[model samples]
Target: MYSPIINISALEPLYLPHEMPTCHRIRAKKEGAPAEAVKGRRPTDVTIAQNLRPEVNIWREADYPGASDTTRELLHHWFGRDHSITTADGEVIPFRY
Candidate 1:
């Protein structure tokens, strides 16, 4: 069982652009659409897209040293079965796939 020393760091967040009119139109289709829901006015699709920032690392050249083919392969293979990874600094982070 070869477990690599994973480095834990905050990678840059990825922002995806959304089609506003399409989103608004879709939202408009839903019945009983309220100007405000629960806490506040439901955020528009544009707002939701802006706030939906995610940092992703793939098993390729994209993230480099921070990511590797071996790591991705292992993670994918052991994901649900193993459930965790030991970082370089010795932190055992639990991940759900």
Candidate 2:
């Protein structure tokens, strides 16, 4: 699931501690896609496919300012049914636990 995060007060870098270090990637896309992510051993989703599109390369902007319901649904699922988030429009979103 992928959701757009607005009002990022700070996006600091997270480095591995001396005892624990891991590298990762931030995949941002351009084209719109359904908001669902696989939940088991094999994990992937439409975002991955859309992001892979030639035009949807890794960029620093959202595919759309306010992603469609599909995007929200997918993201909600991927993130877990138990979290809460706020939209840019001040809408409070509470996930199902």
Candidate 3:
């Protein structure tokens, strides 16, 4: 299945750390074929519409103090303006903080 896109802006500010490489993990249920058939496929394999659970992990860099502009730039670089990710079955799922 397609991986979910993360919305950094939607995340709780309290959960975000000032340190670099703040790791974020997200999980979603699979929808489509059986898991046995897709067992050996790569995580990003989009060849077949397989029912698979996809997890997305991202590490964000640290932001400078009082640097709203820099933070916005980082956010854009990490997550696009739309903040919606499409799955293998063409399902769009919004990221939850």
- Per-model TM-score on C-alpha atoms: 0.20, 0.18, 0.22
Model 3 ranges off by over 4 Å: 1-63, 66-72, 76-82
- Tens digits of per-residue lDDT for model 3 on 1-97? 9886554543454232322233443333454322222223234456343432221112333333345887868766655444568999999986622
- Runs in model 2 deviating more than 4 A are 1-65, 82-97
Ranking of predictions according to TM-score: 3, 1, 2
lDDT, candidate 1, residue 60? Answer: 28
lDDT of 2 at 97: 36
Candidate 1, residue 70: Cα displacement in angstroms equals 19
lDDT per residue as tens, model 2, 1-97: 9897542422432342221123333433444432232232232486765456434322213433466779756755654346679999999886543
lDDT of 1 by residue, 1-97 (tens): 9875432321221221221121111122344442221332235579555455323223222443565778866755754253578999999986553
Total backbone clashes of candidate 2, pairs 3 or more residues apart or in separate chains: 3
lDDT (0-100) at residue 1 of candidate 3?
A: 94
**Of the candidates shown, which would achieve the greatest lDDT relative to the real structure?**
2
**lDDT, candidate 3, at 16:** 29
